[model samples]
Target chain A: MNRLFVFCEGPDDIRFFEGVLKSELREGYASVELIAYAGMKHIRVDGFIRGIGAMGDDYLMVADIDSDRTVKAKKNRLKRWYRELDTDKVIIVIKEIEGWYLAGLNDHASRSLGLRPLPGTDRITKERFNRMIPDHYVSRIDLMIEIIKRYSIKVAREKNRSFRFFYWKCLE
Target chain B: MRIKQVSCRNFKSFSDLTVDLDEYNILIGTNAAGKTNFIRIFRFFRDIARHGLGNAISLQGGAEYIRNIRISSDVPTEIGIIFENELGVFSGVRDTRGGSHTLSFHQIEYRFSLQIEEGGYRILEDFLRISCSCTPDLGEGESGQGELRITHTEDGVFYELSTPEGIAIEITEIIPPYLQKNVPRSGTLLIENPLLVPMPGFQRFFAEIAIYDFDPRTPRKAIPLSGRSDLEEDGSNLAIVLKGILADPEKKRRLSNLMTELLPFVQDIDVRKFMDSSIYFTVTERYGDEHPLPSSVISDGTVNVINLICALYFDEKPFIVIEEPEKNVHPYLIARVVSMFGDAARNKQILITTHNPGVVRHADIEDILLISRDSAGYSIITKPARREEVRTFLKNEVGIEELYIQNLLGL
Candidate 1:
């Protein structure tokens, strides 16, 4: 069976992708497996791509924009490490995965989580996400789990530009 | 005999877990992920066989410590083991015609469940089943299928053996006289009278399963001369075991060579006996004018390494479990220590739990079991090599230590 191996940066990014792609990817692929590389700097991009290609399995590399100014610049940065890296297979999250998480919430879901409804989340950072978390949640992972349940891919694509691009490129 | 598989339900942190074990197993997990609890299962069985079920439960700090906290009192704590008998101890059975037949079973499975009662726990169910192939000992050996099952339910303990002709017969009379009277209500019947069991190999196998949670300080103390040759769980009897090893010229030379190889400064390792007849292991160093350093003066890591060597090489146990082999050892020597475990695993099944990335770096991906906790706080075990994604990363020459550090391999 053809398997989809999605490599994300960290646990938060994995949680987001698992919430979004878990059911959606199963239609075309037998199973979807997620690998959290923890950080972008740790990945051996060239070897990872080559190895996955050798296995004849589809993979998506998810990364946060971080300090990179544009998605094109981010792709170029990754290409410097691996020239043969398929830039089209790379999905760049605007700011961070936390932003994509917040982008999924509508007004009711946002209010339920004790946060304001966020119309756009392209500029959201981890620090901003932490500060916005309500005092009721036990920990960051706790809130992430609750947010994933109410997450809406439709709302996420509409509220975040990078997520919209990811929807068009990978999902749709 | 080697344990092929283990299953536990409502036992400590494992609500329900079943894992197939290889010859060598390296368990990696964070604190409170139930690695220690998993290791305790072997010791629990060993204590039950050597001691009694009540004593085994008491040794683990009573019934509260045995059952999972999440589970209710009514739910029974179950443990099952499947063993591959290597010695073929029970290889023959007498037929109905008074003829001997060569009987061989591929595997023996034993399972028991205990329910937590008011004062303590009682055996809810005990089951043992062996499926065997029988070949006539006479001319023209033709194989026939048969099965033997022993179960202890509320009604009473019963033994049922099916002949090669597929005729079922009650063989409860075969149970020893001592076992019939001692049909334990609060203890396991199999453990209470292991010798009386149809297949007696499992009792010896269970009794010899050694678990070492070495205390480096205990080995540093002087141990009185005793007949105990086997290394103790806490390594309290290291000096005695070492004395036995050193008595053999060949084994002594090998021990000296291994110690020197692991600890470069070590010249030789020898036993020192005092006037009181108590003995301690001394390490003679090559550096700074050779002088023998008593175990008390030796570093904790060095003592731990010595204890590990004795536990892995000198011990006669068929299965061994060591907790945190990298406890105090230097990072540079972790690979060598892990390799020693691999070498020892060739003959006997070895399982070691470690948090060190160096151990993971040197270990085969197939031998490593990742233990993680679910959201509900139940322990889960998974093999990284079984995952296609982990295999891909490994194929790319990406070190497992990196994957472990990155929490990429299912933390």
Candidate 2:
């Protein structure tokens, strides 16, 4: 039941992005659900946070600066709620930004520059990453995928490692 | 066969409004409160979205006539309808927003933008979205916005629309292997058909869609001899339909039986055309002498019944829309007519708009709607009469006739 959901501002956004991503990702990823609502003015982080119950799995959500309201406040509020509710279950991305800046980070291009250095994850190659980053047509989905993969691995590693094993080995 | 919701903006008497719906919508408001206008707007948007910009716009007299006579262009002329498809469940929601959002339920979302330009109305944009989902957590799947994914079958294409953006990559391509060879014809979603929005291959994609207005003035004509059968908006081709029915005696017998059950007076339909200018039909009675009933001489009630039957029995469309079904029909038959619609709608989506209390009362309360007007000049559609304060008046103080009179008088 672990499904991925992508929310866009308009129907065209949903259509265009899905078309582009479906070609890049494998068949399983093609089933990712995209929802589009027009003239939507709210950035309620809880809408996505509350959405996790139905997913029963991890989620990667992307929202853009469609409203004139405080992007930072909205982003921070959502991040706080998501971390409070399910720390590793949600990933929020905001685009159409003046510059790419993931919340809680000060460096501009370190992650946002659309670089993929990891091996075996050619799925998010640097070329495709750079290709999707510049224009307003669609945000860098490759990078979005990368961020999701990284968090997914981190969550898995933390979950699988046991501290008692190290203590038991030292005592023996 | 119910209108579940309606929203209107910059339309006749509405500036901006949204109303939820029920099985039978009893649109009540003071005189000139915009009930019929609200109803017509639903069909108008549907016509434009299902058909195309040209057809949708043409129905309101003309482009010039479609412009809001009372409001400015600053407010877009808009309307939306939410109703049950063939199933007892709600199926889709449509609006004039130039965008559509499909839900996980067996529903579709359509939107169009209408604006006044150079003293005429023009569609700025149009979109049609349908919903699909699998068993476990289909809600997320159904909320997709994308091009409809189609499975071309022997009968027709089986369409599954992802979110308007298109299908995602994560979900396994679950279609049968036999259906994999067909390549999607690109730009198919942008074509305009007279009956539906510009979805590629409309006939192949949505041949199951039908519309019946129950109008007696100009009934729908049937396809000619040995022609493919289709339900016309007006019930004109009753003879052609009869001919088609007669050609297949098995189906003809079933039609005869259904007719007998519904209308005991009807024996069998006589198919004929006169003067090459008009097609006419007569009813053969079981006991008395047979008589010709000129298409013109036939009562509106009979014409409406024939039209409803053509839509219910003959047509194979998956979606059927009925407007003002109570018009010209006897109140006692409304329940039977609704039951027939329900039976026919088993495999298709059925949408209806009406204001008759007899019709409303016979329907399950969940199917009833109370359409009212708000101060902001919007039409507010709601369900479960008990939810609204105005419902009390209908439940206690006034009769349906008074409600109808008050609604027309804009009291």
Candidate 3:
């Protein structure tokens, strides 16, 4: 049986992927492992890809489209570091992972978190997401934990175009 | 009683800083970030309690060296600590059954500052205050709430005791003749006459704050059988301490189980007295034909692990400060060592400094105190858990070791 290894840029991305998408990934692989590099730039992507390849396992690299206008531009930026990177296996989060977290909340879940239901979340930055957190939540981490618990994949796919593309192309 | 807070001014790398201490604290930072200097504060207090203030200052290379180099010599070096006893209120009176009741204080705040003089140092300021609430039923006159305050000024030292009714009385009239004759000018009255402080175990608590920076070679060497049961700062008397622990069947079994769990090769450990009136421990391996290996032939890591176990388990000190507990410890066994320290912390306060990622990975965010240097080279201490970014990273399961390695903790 083949193993699927999902690499994330940081713990927030890892938590979102593991909490909401691990089962979807398990459909095509016997086992799924989530690894966080803490930050994408800190990792030597080529070495990690080769190391995982040598283990006879498939990998998915997840990143945020920070400051990049398009997925093609983001891929181009990453290509400067490792030209041989399998851009086909790369999945870019629209704007940031905070956007994906916001995308998962439906009207009821949003109101429960003391937030208003958002039509779309492609432009949600970390600062904007933090501003949306209710006063009762002690910290951003606390709000993030609650968001993961109530995350709805179907709502996320409808609210985020990049998430919809990721679901269809990779998870589906 | 346990130390709840410590403040230092112009002391080593600390110009003016205060840090709150928990039951278990882990100090993490780059080399020369003042972790050692922070631990030195405890040692300074211990020295002052055991020896006089003058000797304690000299032990750290005199007042000039003890003070922050950036600050001028005219600025007095200051150190203060607050202790709290959470157990219960203590009664100082003796019961009718001929048994003496334990004397304890609810809170103690002591602060002192000294200036570097021409030939030697002189005490510029000395202060100590203790507050306690006694049960009315304990004794006839011991029922009311009272506070004792000792202050030193330009004129002379004054001892004042106040009652719950706000009535203050000069306690100097009742001072013992011996203490009056030996009024300290170069030292604190609290250290000079701890018996006069009205609290038992206060002096011992400060004097017995054990700070260990273990050297494996010292533990490997055989020490005289007459060595004290307490583990030395360098762990030179490991055998003597282990001998005391092994005498108790319960502690010995726990130690044996821990050794086997940490060092799988070991079957048992035993101490032996040599013909030269010295003693050392030997480790029994499960498979080796040379069943019991002497301490001399044991590995440095093994000796250090044993010494640490003895220190954490056997030492009766109220506070234990160890520098770099991961030193010579294998990565695999580092978790066990840290877990042992955590378990031991429940009974007494434990503080450790570490540069090892394994140690940080196993520690809770709240237990960690990050030390960094400011632009002026003064040490700054902050709890990473209190920082918003750190909490976000940690709540998302990012290993703190990663944050430390990447310098993402914001120093």
Q: iRMSD per model?
A: 18.9, 21.7, 13.6
Model 3 stretches with alpha carbons more than 4 Å out: A1-172, B86-104, B138-146, B153-156, B165-182, B185-189
Could you tell me how far off, in angstroms, the CA of residue B186 lies in candidate 2 after the best superposition? 18
**Candidate 1: pairs in clash:** none
Total clashing pairs in model 3: 0
- Please identify model 1 stretches exceeding 4 Å from their true place: A1-172, B90-92, B165-186
Best by DockQ: 3
User: CA lDDT of each candidate?
Assistant: 0.79, 0.47, 0.78
Candidate 1: tens digits of C-alpha lDDT, residues B129-188: 877776766745567776678787767667777766643333542445566554544456
Q: Candidate 2: where are CA atoms >4 Å away?
A: A1-172, B1-8, B19-32, B45-51, B62-70, B77-108, B120-210, B215-228, B273-279, B290-299, B384-411
DockQ of each: 0.01, 0.01, 0.02
Evaluated against the true structure, the overall lDDT of model 3 is 0.78
Q: Pick the candidate with the highest TM-score.
A: 1
The RMSD of every model to the true structure, in order and in angstroms, is 21.1, 25.2, 12.8
In candidate 2, chain A reaches a TM of 0.35
**Candidate 2 residue-wise lDDT, B156-197, digit = tens:** 334453444443422123333444344323222222332232
True contacts kept of each: 0.00, 0.00, 0.00
User: Who is ahead in lDDT, 1 or 3?
Assistant: 1
lDDT of 1 by residue, A1-172 (tens): 8888887775466556666667887778889987655423334566667787898988888888999999899989877755657888888988998898899899999998899898899999988997897865424554666677788899988999988998898779
